[model samples]
Target: MRCLLVLPLLLAAALAAVPPLLGPTLPPGTELRLLSADLRTLHGAWRVEGRRLLPLSPPLAPKAGQEVQLLLVLPGEKPRAFPGMAERGDVFLPWEKEQVSLLRLLKEVYGLAPPERLWP
Candidate 1:
């Protein structure tokens, strides 16, 4: 009987020692390399205003190896972005009820995408 109680405690400790599933959070102001030219024309990215995408003209031309930062702003919260590019498909944000693709965001939001890749 005493062993059972101790077993639960041991299990709890073991689970606590396990690291979280989510990747490590990136610190603010971390510089990222420009991997795509579409990112340079990010200024042309559109904004979502009640299902309307308003266009903006950006005259930026960032070259390869140019340091850039990507920031994402959600309603009523601070801006945030995660590192590490996904191999394919859209990453689902269950909490936000939205799915997003890093490749798309890089091109649409920052106008950047790898030279060998095509922009949407």
Candidate 2:
């Protein structure tokens, strides 16, 4: 019957209208590393040191004096670095429009649960 066919089509249309459900949530303490820069020319390994963020290692730590730059390879364009001071137990980067969104993305990718508060 035309009504029966229309019913299935309507069901299909309804399903399509719904957005795909997100997968299981990530656990806490998970870390994400955004590429600090293009390392195609440089030679060495770098370690991640923050949540949903990456920081340059001290030149003397392992690969001392190696030239490196942070290049964010996101959709819009190069990644911009948020500048801030490190005090107590947090790295304070300058607040920007994308800062919160970036942090949330990093948390999702890294499987980090929402924190009680931003680091001070």
Candidate 3:
């Protein structure tokens, strides 16, 4: 019946309307790993600017990976033993190659502005 078919469609729409769970913003120095990722090319390397990591040069695409690591220089800050999730706006510095790249979470209404970068 048309009503039955529409019911499924309505359910699907409702499910689709649900927004994704954007995980909490990970603090600076949170070490992340590159389990899997996509390659991106940028003009320059990443550096810490205030509380955010902005590129010295214009960003080509974004050297974003599925996971990454963060390094902190403060006292009593050490890497974790177990693995966990990395959400958007998480900024990480790549000390070695074959690792994930930095992240600048942009979660605004327009999503055009970059989120605050977390650095130690």
Candidate 4:
């Protein structure tokens, strides 16, 4: 009888602890390198001058002359394009999502602690 009663409580406690243990909270300034270019056309040498930051969606797709942003583990670190895009000889990030601006995304994605000034 006692074992049955204790089991549910133990299970609940264990489940509650699971989420935090899964991963460290990202820092505010950290960034993730996401891809954002077409890879079907490129065949081989993808290293070229066509790459840019990750795109934004909903309002519009990224295009030339537009400033795309990325969430990177390290700011300004560039990533390689996909096979198709590479064959075309251009670099590109291929993923797109709508959210905060690049600077804020970097902070949230990386799980950086709040700024000193913001702290009480």
Q: Which candidate is the best by TM-score?
A: 1
Better of 2 and 3 by TM-score: 2
For model 4, the local distance difference test gives 0.29
Candidate 1 C-alpha lDDT tens digits along 1-120: 999999999977855543321223222322223222234324123333432323334324433333333334444546554332222222222223343444444334333332223222
- Candidate 1: residue 7 Cα off by (Å): 47
TM-score, each model?
A: 0.29, 0.23, 0.22, 0.20
lDDT of 4 by residue, 3-84 (tens): 9999999977854433321124433333333233432221111111122222222122233323333323422445422211
* lDDT measured at residue 92 in model 2 versus the true structure, 0 to 100: 28
Local accuracy by lDDT, each model:
0.36, 0.33, 0.34, 0.29
Between prediction 1 and prediction 4, which has the larger TM-score?
Answer: 1
Winner by TM-score between candidate 2 and candidate 1: 1
lDDT of 2 by residue, 10-72 (tens): 877854443321223222322222222343432211233333233333221213222233233
Displacement of residue 20 (Cα, Å) in model 1 is: 18
Candidate 1 stretches greater than 4 Å from native: 1-45, 49-54, 82-101, 105-120
- What is the Cα-based lDDT of residue 56 in candidate 4? 26
* Decoy 3 TM-score against native: 0.22
* Error at 52, model 3, angstroms: 3.8
Question: Candidates 3 and 4: which is better by lDDT?
Answer: 3
Which is superior by lDDT, 1 or 3? 1
